[model samples]
Target: MIILRTPRLTAHLAVAALFGSSLLLASCADADTTSNTSSVSSSASDSPTSPVSDSSAEGTGAGNGGTDSGASMLPSGSSSSADEAGQGVGGNASETEEAPKTSDEAVSEAVNRVNRDYPNKFGGWVFKGDTNFDSAADLTYAKVEQAQQGNAQYETLLIFFHKGEYLGIDSTYPQQVVSTAPSSRGLEVVYKDWEALRDSGDANAAAGKYTSTVTYYWDGAQVQHEGRIPNTGL
Candidate 1:
């Protein structure tokens, strides 16, 4: 090592060297700090973090909410299939059958049929039992007689009808009494001549000794007539 020539000069040189060394250390420290800051900025820029979109979050929320709310809106005690099938409130079909015809209605129909068909034939003639017509075994009968003028009797006739259809007609002897009865088979029309009994003057004649019986039955296509029975003389 070389020694200094003068003491003051050595002291000044030593001070200058010390100051230069401090400046160099300060510059090195600042450079190191700047380099560390730049490395951290580069790393943060390279590894990017993705942000969530508003549309994706809203779509997920709607998908979960729609499933639960759709089931609660249905009516009670009914399913969606029931509505689609068009079922009624009472769950039954409507009744469309018509009511049956009454007896009075049937009688009215018979009267109307006669009036419509034979209007001019029985204008002045009167019906025997217009107010008290009784239809039985699907057969209806009406007796028409000429109007009595001063106790004079005219032609008397019996008209037969089946279910409002006109059948054949029969007439009793003039001035003879006639009666009718209904049975399961058909209608029975009986004829009695009171004049014969009156003329006989027999006491036993009051017991219907001269009564004749005739039965009329229906055969689906038309009315049928059985042969007349002879009168039984009591």
Candidate 2:
């Protein structure tokens, strides 16, 4: 259609056309941005968070139940023999070697060793620490007494040892009392022979005083009789 074209209308029409072209370009750019965003979201949702093989996932699920299992799937304290062996390896001296035994432990071990090796050899003897009547000696000496049932008289034996090795025994005669003391070089044992007083006419003479006194000393190798003193009167 042939229409009148005014200068002002022509300039207005040109400005409108330019504005329309600008809006169309902006709308196309927005649509392209939305499509790209939607495509990226779809790709993210389809892909797995972590890359893992199907076989690996199945094996893990079979043993550990799922991908996010608890501490049960982790290694325990005694998990493997290799782990236990590793604990004692290297410079783990505390785990490899045992702790040093205490004095009480050594005494108990010595007593048990003697009892187990020589069962009933000491005549049903009772250990020193086991009874109030008996006296306790140092670790180097163990004093044991023959079990005194109803009688007041029993034999006592002094066992000598050097660092857990059994040396020898010094025993008192029946109806005699024996005592021990630590000497400068070794140990001293004194025996009171009251059996000689049994023949005395006095009823309480035997229990009142001993008839003789004998001293013995341990000179490392063996126990030697030092000397003897006799009591003439009770």
Candidate 3:
């Protein structure tokens, strides 16, 4: 009876030890499954799901910053460029407006026109002799004849005529006596047919005569004068 009881006790002790070992193994497996689940959740949370949306937001922020910086810098640069262009245009306009008109140009234009239009009427001589007398035996002929017959008469007469008339004239004296004496007799005459001279600020006809009473003088080299004539008729 004692030997049988000892065998049964040993067998019961072995069965308990096996049961405890199985429980411990089940607990370890449960802990390992929980750990694996926690690791998977952490990895999933770290992953970027909406890559396109996140990149778009960052790009929008950068674009807005760039636009603000560019807008702030525009006014100063644009205004300076505009001002420089305006100054250049104004300088060019001033230079063009201030250009000069010369006296030689005006004189040359007048002389050329007169010579071209009145080719035949104007004689080669610079002065015309008018004696205010009827015949060779007339009263006041000797003085003018003597002066004309002198050696230096041609040169003196040319200066005097040019000073009075501003035009060339014939060498011969007039046939008829229009006046008794030389009082306001000399005149600067331009023909009505001379359109060029007429257009170039010359005096017009009045009472059937286009005559200018303004005096002219040659100071050895060039002709000089001081007078203003109305181009239109009186």
Candidate 4:
């Protein structure tokens, strides 16, 4: 019982040393393998799939981002429906038609037509001469220049025809006289041809012997005429 077992103790110590060394080597190998594996994974992630590539990562990124594709596509049918509703089928129809003539143009055309139809039928009647009781006196067709100045505002033509010739003619005397008069006169020249008396009266008025003038007018036409009484003061 008191004797020492040195060989047995030595064998036990050697077995423990071997076991510790194996454990350290195994741990170191495990660490190295883990680091190498991590590096290899990072390298694989960085490498491009196509080796001689003109292709870019930016293009791939844009495809993945999804915004570019949406922008390139055409609008839907519902958008077209909205545009059609806003425009309506009748739009611009009125603009395609011709505009009508103006009022001024129409009026000018009417005046032209009247002038063409009634071209100065009473031209070359003597306008000025002394009054005579006989039928041979110079009768004139003068315009009414001023109603108060013994002048006519319309184409009031003077005539020397016998009173009977004008009076008996239908649509001649009364019509012409009334149409010519600016205002009705009392005790108007009844029997004699009234033109002589009226003309004399107008001459007297122009000489300042009277306060008013007498004139004549033509009743039926678009055009007008006027006559000026000669001044006796000149």
Q: Which number leads on lDDT? A: 1
Clashing pairs in 3: none
lDDT of 2 by residue, 58-79 (tens): 0001112222222111111111
* Candidate 4 per-residue C-alpha lDDT over 16-116 given as tens digits, one digit per residue, 9 for 90 to 100: 88998999999999999999999999988875442221221111110111222221111111010011112224442121222432433323332333234
Off by over 4 Å in 3: 1-4, 49-234
Off by over 4 Å in 4: 1-6, 48-234
TM-scores of the candidates in the order shown: 0.37, 0.39, 0.19, 0.19
Question: lDDT tens string, model 1, 1-234?
Answer: 987679898888999999989999999999999999999999878763433222211001101112222111111111111112222444643333334446556445545644554443325445656422343334566666665544322444455544433343443234233567776767776666444565678654363676656665555544455534322221
Candidate 1 deviant stretches above 4 angstroms: 1-123, 130-137, 149-155, 172-177, 194-209, 229-234
| Ten-residue stretch with the least lDDT total in model 1 | 56-65
What is the RMSD, in Å, between candidate 3 and the native fold over all Cα? 38.2
lDDT, residue 65, candidate 4: 19
Cα distance off (Å), candidate 3, residue 104: 87
**Candidate 1 at 133: error in angstroms?**
5.7
**16-51 in candidate 3: lDDT tens per residue?**
999989989998999999999999999888764422
The C-alpha lDDT values of all candidates are 0.47, 0.44, 0.29, 0.29
Which has the greatest TM-score? Answer: 2
Residue 91, model 1: lDDT of: 63
